[model samples]
Target: MFDAGLSVEEPVRGVVLLRIDRPQALNALTTASAHGMIELYTRLALRTDMRALILTGAGESAFSTGADLKERAGMDAMAARAQHMAHRLAFSIRRGFDFPVIAALNGIAHAGGAELALSSDLVLAVPHAGFALPEIRRGIMPGMGGTQALTAALGPRRAMELLLTGDALDAETALACGLVNRIVAPEALVSEALALAERIAEAPPLAVSAVTRAVRGAGQGGAEAGLALELALHQRLMASDDRLEGARAFAEKRRPVWKGE
Candidate 1:
């Protein structure tokens, strides 16, 4: 259920590594690539054991520049909208994921690439990595949910500035602004991200999903709503079999075997 230009692998149990394989094109996302992503995520939904996902690019040059404009050069207005819709659909599926999603930026993340990283629950980039939203240069806008996601990642003022200026944000500045969680070595980027994912996979899936959902909701929902959601998810988890097992394991002083209930 995979496609060309995308590589899916399970280097460790319960963690999926998805690499954009079009390094020759800077991993730019064509409409077909977006459709491929939709198909890939749809197929991944059947894997109940998956606890984490790490998205990265194939090479050291770039994570992605996004929207293969070369391919879009011939597209008419209707065709462009269709392309936009495909990318939007792919991003929507990613946004709906309950498991933690990590973007391992090996190099530059520009345009929709930046949006992709923003969509993730965590972002780990290389020390030399750069992020930018340059859609304005093309007389377009960041339509791949970047406007909202960037605003949530950065404050509204910062996001507005970046969107308007179309400037690149260095990895250090991005880290200082809380856009990236860590700045890893280029060689260690994917491995470190995968290691983190492996660690996350050790925990109970139910708790992980609930935590991601509740915390990510804070961006859109006010504090009151966020608190309400957290409480609701917590209440739901209280009755789960995994919670009972956790208690039993604590009493027994043993590692809890989570059934993901």
Candidate 2:
């Protein structure tokens, strides 16, 4: 079990949990935390048994306040650059995770914290958890891939308005705007996320990977290319060992055992 400055727990099989540990700092992302997150994600990406990941903060107060500006305060130009790179690495880690990455937003996620939540495949928020991009208030903009992901999720008009004004939106508003996939009680956040992950995990791993790849490919090309990729992936998954197990289980009237092939 790697500490990585933060804490990680796997309460459900095949679903990893990553929690931001700096609750005293409202779970802010320091350089160490950022690097640790990247490392965790990178490592998890290679695990065949890991089917999904869930990211959350330690407490109900905040998911993350984003970057730890206080930690970087008084840093020289070189150090600042290094910090920025570390932040980028954290974002890349989330992006590169092959299986589903779910964000369990237990509380407020502002600036970088909000970016992190938005980076996930699905965001399940507490009923009162708020989202915001207040970088403009700091005379800056979102440094992580927040801008791009927010734009992709919420579209240009809303993204520009939020980024330009640094306004915060409540959980209800976030759900209404399609920023979060679902909302639940603060106490139920983890359970809800885990339930969703387990449901996905129970399916054939190859089919899940194919679905993820096909959806990712759809944004890069016209329908023709997307269809071709989808068909190719479908063929590959159908011939996988897991598919045979699925067929055998169906014939036997039992649950399939996934080999993750």
Candidate 3:
């Protein structure tokens, strides 16, 4: 059910790490890669064993430069639209997944790359992992849902500034602006992401999924609604076998064996 275009591995239980492998193209989101991403997400969503996901790219140079302009070069408008749609669908699926999705940004993520990171539930970027939307300079707008996702991650004013200027925002700026959750040395990125995912996966799986969904529904409701949803999830988790084991282990001062019940 997996493809060779992208690499997938479960380095830790309940977390699937996906890496974009076309390092020659700066891991650019070609049409085939975009569709492959969508298919990968679909397959992962069906896996009961997975509780979270981490997305990254291969090589030390880039997380992704965004879409492969060279791949789209010479294609007609219709072909371009289809290609862009595939990319959009890929991001949308990642954003809407029931399980938490974390972005381990290892390098420069410009244009489409920034959009991809924005789709994740959390982003932990490397110190050299710069982010930007330089499509305006390319005489185009970000078509892969970057406009809205970027604005949602950062405020509209900042998002507009980044998009309009087509300038690069280094990891520091991205962290300061709340665009990225954390920044660490590139050498530590993969282990850090896996550790974070492992911590998340330690909790009750059902509660984790519900919390993810509830927080994502924040725009439709306020804090009260979100809290209510959290409470409901907590109640459900408390009744699960995993919660009982967690409590007994806490009292006994031993590690609990989670059943993900």
Candidate 4:
């Protein structure tokens, strides 16, 4: 559905795998690819069967090097502005996905690519993978949630240092900075990501969605507001059929078959 720039696969039931396929360009995102991603996420949002999504690059060299500079160089100011808007829309769709989204960073994720990884709920990167926001070096600044997301993930000071210096963070440093959940070997990256997705997909869908929403709310608001949101979501989930099924299954000593209610 994403043309040649992206590809989709159902590696397991209820789990969707999305790969950025422009390895020859270090999996860089052109305008077409960005719009394709937005369209794909929009369609996926309406699918009842989608439980989790894993995003990665097609090759080991890069998750993505960010925007296709060659394409950007040829664009006028108006065209650049339009492309920026498209990228923002795509990232927003990624961050708003109801189910869990995992970023499997197999290689270098620079500039917009790093921003994309930040949008994911969880990140699993390979040992050889590295991340950076080198837009500063190119006489530009990150425009795709880079600064804000970095500040939220790392503290303001740390984020500032990286953004100002345009230095690359290795996998270990990224993990320490809380940008990634875990680091796996290159060969194990996909397997580990899929295993994590499968585990999440096995949970009750309604409860999973509630947790995702509540946690995201907490990140965006104060403690008091977050607590209120959590309570409201908990109350709402209590009335769902999946909650009843879960309780019944526990009492019967069997697995609950969730209907995503």
For 32-83, candidate 3 gives per-residue lDDT tens digits of: 8888888888887778888789989999889989888997897899998998
lDDT of each: 0.89, 0.85, 0.85, 0.90
Error of 3 at 17 (Å): 1.7
Error of 3 at 172 (Å): 0.8
In terms of TM-score, how similar is model 3 to the real structure?
0.88
Predicted candidate 2 versus true structure: per-residue lDDT over 1-261, tens digit per residue: 555448999888789998888888989888888788777877887787888889999888999998888977878979977988898887876676668888999899999899888877789999879999999988788878788878877889999999999999999999998989989988888999999999999888888878876775665568889889999999998788998899999999998998778
Clashes of each: 0, 1, 0, 0
Give candidate 4's whole-model lDDT. 0.90
Question: Candidate 2 at 30: error in angstroms?
Answer: 0.5
C-alpha RMSD values across all candidates: 1.2, 1.9, 2.4, 1.2
Could you tell me how far off, in angstroms, the CA of residue 34 lies in candidate 1 after the best superposition?
0.9
Residue pairs in collision within model 3? none
Instruction: Give the Cα-based TM-score of candidate 1 against the true structure.
Output: 0.97
Summed over model 4, clashes come to 0
TM-scores for all predictions: 0.97, 0.92, 0.88, 0.96
Predicted candidate 4: what Cα RMSD to the true structure? 1.2
Overall local distance difference test of candidate 2:
0.85
Q: What's the true lDDT of residue 158 in model 4?
A: 89
154-228, model 1: which lDDT tens digit per residue?
879988999999999999999998999999989888889988998899999999999999878984667888889
Better of 1 and 3 by lDDT: 1
